[model samples]
Target chain A: MKKHLTIALDAMGGDQAPAVVVHGAHLARERYPDVHFVFFGRSDDVQPLLDAAPLLKKVSRFVHTDDVVQAEDKPGKALRRSRQSSMALAIESVKAGECDVAVSAGNTGALMALAKFILRTLPSIDRPALASLLPTYKGECVMLDLGANVECDASNLVEFSVMGAAFARTVLGLQRPRVGLLNIGVEELKGNEEVKEAAEILRTSDLPMEFCGFIEGNMIGAGETDVVVTDGFTGNVALKAVEGTAQLIGRLVGDAFRSSWRARLGYLLARRGMNGLRDHLDPNHHNGAVMLGLNGLVVKSHGGATVEGYATAIGVAIDMAHHNLIHLITKDLGGVAMDRQESEPLTLETDKQAESKSA
Target chain B: MKKHLTIALDAMGGDQAPAVVVHGAHLARERYPDVHFVFFGRSDDVQPLLDAAPLLKKVSRFVHTDDVVQAEDKPGKALRRSRQSSMALAIESVKAGECDVAVSAGNTGALMALAKFILRTLPSIDRPALASLLPTYKGECVMLDLGANVECDASNLVEFSVMGAAFARTVLGLQRPRVGLLNIGVEELKGNEEVKEAAEILRTSDLPMEFCGFIEGNMIGAGETDVVVTDGFTGNVALKAVEGTAQLIGRLVGDAFRSSWRARLGYLLARRGMNGLRDHLDPNHHNGAVMLGLNGLVVKSHGGATVEGYATAIGVAIDMAHHNLIHLITKDLGGVAMDRQESEPLTLETDKQAESKSA
Candidate 1:
């Protein structure tokens, strides 16, 4: 018999909490019958919601906490004051081995801060990166460092490439994912110092991955590479830009269809096609953004996500837990780090020297 | 009668070359009866195309130049060796006051490098930024520093905001355009030192524009502001991402419509609406990217743009020339720079001191 995958939930987090969290868990429970949930929030608020879903109630246990982290609470303030908060407690549950993975639809900064503080990073990882799967023309691709660290060095970027590739491999089921560094231009001489340095290291390093030197922003949606690595700032902006553009086009198409009776009739005939298009691009289908490099798994659902979206986030957590994603990432990272140490010790030393000099 | 606006064209540049250039000139001439053109390329290559368009030939003069700058030519190499090249001669015409503006569909880097070297920057401007129009939900908006300078300081961003606002006011016909600094987050403390410093400056400055504190990438397409100011690196990436997303959605929508007979029938009936959308989001409709801050007006058309796209680029040059865009930018910059100098001389001194100390 297989062991049930356990997931801790931050029930009081997102805009529409406890209710969506409970309902989402019920939906996920239907899909993964062998999954159990540990809900963290005020039991009074969560108990009533769970009472409606008997299946979810049967497999879920509530951990009562009166304190709740506000959406606007700064990362530092939350880390210091929100020890008993639902978000923090959920992450702590993962740290305590009570759950295999933690899922939160909370303030991103607060969640990331608490997860990092509680779980810490993998031994070879310097900083944890936020990674998500984005639908591309070719297929779905994984992009990393999505607003985790505002600024990242060459080493941080290299680490993100490894993590993102590992993610694409495990989540998307690619055998050997192609990784590319995001830059303004594809030329070797383009971009800032850090990107150039990262490319140089990736090109010469003994990392067991296909490193496609550099890719521009336009090529990202073209699925030119399976894994796209960038600093948190660029990654966040690029992701948002892609989302915005997709939404804008959707709106424009709707407006056009509504313009005339003929068009509206055409829309009726093409409703199925439109639904297919909508479903393909829907955020609910691509809900969870995993905080990679963390010792324990932490999946962050979009703050404004729906019940289905939350359920999808739970599904991602389940899949990752079942597959032992953290173990795979650690093994791959160790291999790459060891190879770099053996082959390019001088580069690593230079990086350390640069960091110390800056410090 | 209004005086005619003379535009110098790099007839040998772009993929389609003299054919598209000459045909585009004909289209522009039809739209603006008072416009004149100077074609710069090998006469044998350009003359035949011009002869076919008798109306364009009537208002155009041909300047023969056999030296063509290849698309792969490096910027530095182009600037040094391509003196008699069509692109160079066309810009020279603008510099010599023979043409009000110079339009090229040549290499972007080559055009920017040469334009900077020949036209030079305005006295108050430190760098020339590339600005372009983008379709937004609200209407149309302008974004600047597309790919001109890869790295920018606080002052460079401030200059871009000022220049971008001027472009919006003069070209887009906005009375007082709202200007925003692009960042990963909208919070005051978010982003790097340069962005934070620029925000601080813009917030307190006496620049005659409504300074929206910060805008995220998602809000750009929502048309949150009339002018979006960012560094060339971020700007270029964001622009490409937007384009990529649009194309990806287009492809997805196409695939969806083709999936079933019902969708095909619907598409046939809704063809008009789709056409409306196609025209709205078409890159051809938004063809020109102006190299702002240059002493002489230099418009860069997309290398692979269609005849209509090239004609639209010509229209942008005509609009800028008619509105005296550079003169307006210069005046506004002078006002802001003077106010800044009067109010924050210490800030300027501190910047210089920091630079020297770092040096």
Candidate 2:
């Protein structure tokens, strides 16, 4: 481990940027005493906020930048204007070895684009997938390719299985995570060509994980496996739908408790236990989504996540960096056949193609 | 309307057949006094059960069929052996105009194949989509192609929108339903080629419903639209994922209430409200899935549905028949651009083609 582990922050990103970014850093500092931050944003806006936290200001370095990537900016537009932007500079720090990892709560598409364009993916990596932790019946399970690639081939899915297992190991602290590829049915005859092909490869692969075969959508939140893998489109829809279902349940539960006087009184008495239920359903409980397959760790927090949520994102970056999640993935991926396409040298042609595809 | 509304029952289908079928028929009889049942099964097995319900016996007719379609029968094998199977005979009754609709709690794939083969799709309809009502915040919303087609083209999605709108209008009683095509993002630029093309057509098509553009998976249960449409692959995954989420919430709620004595006491006091919440989230609340775009009505009840739930499936069939859902779909489809492909000549070639696709 380095004497000082640095986490680069896009201070001006997020819905409540500068403020949440500073406060979240302060909270993360309490958790990791040896951690340092390099804040990349307009100095005038960030300097005053850092002043409020003497401890954080003591270990943090400030770099001024005038460019800001708007939340509505598309990936292609954001990449062209990336040179002076806080998000780009923060990621640049990682590529330049100035920081161990980069953390941002910026436009997800832009963050993904800039990270891929600047740092590039690891060797043999075609695309970096978005990985996040979702609540399940047993506890929490990791799901990957959560909108990174709209469509994925069999090789992409196989790569996802390896990456997802590494994530579960480092983030969730499991030695050999049980991995599953999401499909409509568990039978061999079910699902599309890609899913069936992926299953066949995973069944034979000798990766450092237990391949539990196919998992259906309903079985996702049931905690049937440690890691659920799928194409970006299906994964993204299922994740958001799960979130929506949780919210719907919360709303209905509230309505039920307030339906009558006895129910209202009963709610007051059971407020503690009810609060427990709320905590379980809350998305903020485990807040960070890592862009796996990248050469350097890059974590994306929810744009509208709270102070604690942003801090939790920083925690993920720290854990991955400390535990060497990148090294683990590199070793696991060595055995698998991953296509080579994009490169580190910044070329407009390649980046533009990736930006459009990632868009 | 016919003086007597006849509903065909695959008296040997479902987890609890004959008994549940007869009892469910009795339940529907109470709701609609003009309804009659044509039960197709082994008379030896079903007649004794029917005799227990004298009122149901008074208005029902029995057709002996020793052969039965096992729950695990594949559609292709079942189609070849369907001549004497109870499910096939029940659907044949609909095609022969002996019954207004067919209701079964049997294997969904076999039911869909046999129905499509026997009755065929309406003119200009490429395939019949499986449509069902899902609970939402506002009330109930209809979602279509819930695993009927593994893949769909642009025109198929448009036809689903038309069929889904008709369903919402008849089943949910919405005068002019608001429709939304399921996509990862609400943006026009987002989603696959087929989804975008469907949106363009629906945007300008003078369909008898409101087109609300793209709807993400999260907004499905939020009741943002009365009808949501998607390809079968995505639709089936989302539906089951939603089911998993609901079950997770139910289990968590139970655990929370049992956490403490106060919570348990509170739950007792709020029992009525809790029960209401349970009923709202229960799949049985909206029991039937209709094979829309077909010339005849076919309702699929959950395999494990109770007597009440089976009756609810019958209720959906009765509503569609009373409202002339088929006639409405035929008229609405006349204006839309739909491709015609499959036919009802009972040829081995055509039925085999659809059987493989539907499988």
Candidate 3:
């Protein structure tokens, strides 16, 4: 048998789970002939779809788990209680070295909790962060801690900055990714104390990276920064805003296309151009959010993701596995074992130093 | 000699200060003939521009202050040191009741600090927030805490919610605005403990408003909610993301419109339609960030704002002054003077409760 990239996919997560998840796995199986998928969930729920797909029947395996972690359940509580959930099983596959990567479209909070609880953070890593690839007008930018650790301090932000840069290098094909500290203003002293403190440490820290000072929100999609580091709270909010704005634009185009026959004809005339634009704006095309700094590779898909979205997510998992991104992040960011103090803890005095100089 | 809407303009503020600020003031005077502006800066700087426009000389007054605050100056220090800065003088005009509104595109932090120190928050309001009317595909949404009070707790968010809703109702013509908590997920448990806790308070608080529970980033421009409340950090990030994405889309469209002869021909054919869309997406038209929960009306404009943007900001200030938003916030939400005990500080237990009930 040829060596295959085995991926354990949690099939019972996400808003359209089992159906879209199973379909996505099948679609991915066709695209990547060498990928072997282990679908974890209730066998009864997944069997009908697997039986329907000849390709899935050929290359996929089933790891039965009875519990389904509802999106509504508290993340910590759900992770602890739903021990047999598909998400937990999928992560376990990576922990047990049964699969090269784990993919899920389940409750993101639960996935974060379970993955952190089971696989744990890499040594020296303070916390695991979710890094999402944003398709900007210039090209693509990596936005990290999309919705992971919300209440992060200066040190957590610094760690995130290093980890985000590493991910950008490994996945986004940037050699020395220009890391930007996302703030309201582009000036050096523009953000809250946490951001200000982080900026100071990032400036002087002898990390093998490029620190591109501060970047504001408007520059996020301008392709000014390759890796934008922010706490999960702000990052998640910004990601949603971009997503919301894109969808809003889509709706506006739709409305304009339907207003009048001239408009409709105009819409038909512009359909090709609009489609080209849609090709870039579509969320499904940019499907995966990688949980970085984790010991095991875990990729989360949008909970409302369709089959195509899942396929895109699976592709992300394959890329991460192929490049061994987690291993690289571990090696590059001090093996994730360094204590908080060792990982360049920024002090108020250093921040004051930058402030004084800038002033 | 007709009574005019008097605005104190900070001529020495912003990147293109003295030039763009002077030009913006001239345009506002030309556009709004009954509008009178008091230019705050050196008389020498104003006289040269005033010489060019005889109409500006007729409609404007000058406050000669030599000091100017640089964008990089620390807010607290700048607020103290730049006592005679143009922006400070403009703010003082409003405090002295010499002008209906104070408008500046200068150092935002400094402006905010000065406004708070001089004018203060409304009775019972803990912190003042910057709120703006954001252009959406549907129409517009009111977003609060755009760049004020970055480090906030749940009580601050609740106040933002109240203030944002009132602004939306007063400015955007929304009745009983549906207040949405901007968070990582629609599920209540999906954000930080602060968000979760805020969700619970918003649910039970007697704000005489329509509470739409939780909303994520992408929902803002989708008209999912009329008023979206978040902390300064997240709000600023989200607002900037929208601004950046819009610029990106504009650039892409501009490129496509100029790509080739055939595409250029297509662009010509769709010029009218494209123009309408472009006008709809223009950020300048969405001018002004209202500093909500303040004791007086304070508006912040883009430091790089053109004449039209400043004019629109002045118009918004007129509307704010006309409606007495400050008084409404104080009367309805018990602005900054409330006892700390009654402020209802957020706790982990409330976060857990909100998560279990709604998530």
Model 2 Cα displacement at B186 (Å)? 0.7
Go through the candidates in order and give each one's DockQ: 0.58, 0.56, 0.35
Candidate with more favorable, higher DockQ: 1 or 2: 1
The best candidate in terms of DockQ: 1
* A1-359 per-residue lDDT for model 3 (tens digits): 22778999998998888999999988888899988999999989898888999878789898888998998778878767987888898999999989988999988778888999999888767677889888887778888888787667777788888888887876777788899999878777567767887888788776657889888899988999889999988988898888778777766656655655666655555556666777777788888999888888999999988899899999888888877887677666663333466434344554565477346
> How would you encode candidate 2's per-residue C-alpha lDDT over B1-359 as one tens digit per residue?
57878999999899999788888999999999989999999989999998888998999999999999888888898899877799999999999999999999988889999999999989767778998989998888999888888767777899999999999999899888999999889999888767887898788778799999999989988999999999888888889999999999899999989999999999998888999999998888889999999989999999998988899999999999989999999888776643333222323454565577357
Q: Candidate 2: what lDDT? A: 0.88
Q: Please give the distance, in angstroms, between residue A102's alpha carbon in candidate 3 and its true position after superposition.
A: 1.7
lDDT string for model 1 (A1-359, tens) is: 24788899999989899888988999999999989999999989999898888888999999999999999999999999999999999999999899999999999999999999999999888778999989889878898888998778777888898888878877888878899998888999888777887898787766657999989999889999999999898888889989999989989999989989988998999899899889878988888999999889999999888999999999888878888888888777664533444435655665686487346
Instruction: Tell me the TM-score of each prediction against the true structure.
Output: 0.94, 0.93, 0.85
**Candidate 2 residue pairs in backbone clash:** none
* Per-residue alpha-carbon lDDT of candidate 2 for residues A43-139, written as tens digits (9 for 90 to 100): 8999999998999999999999999999999999999977689999999999999999999999999999999999889886767899999999999
Model 1, residue B59: distance off in Å is 1.3
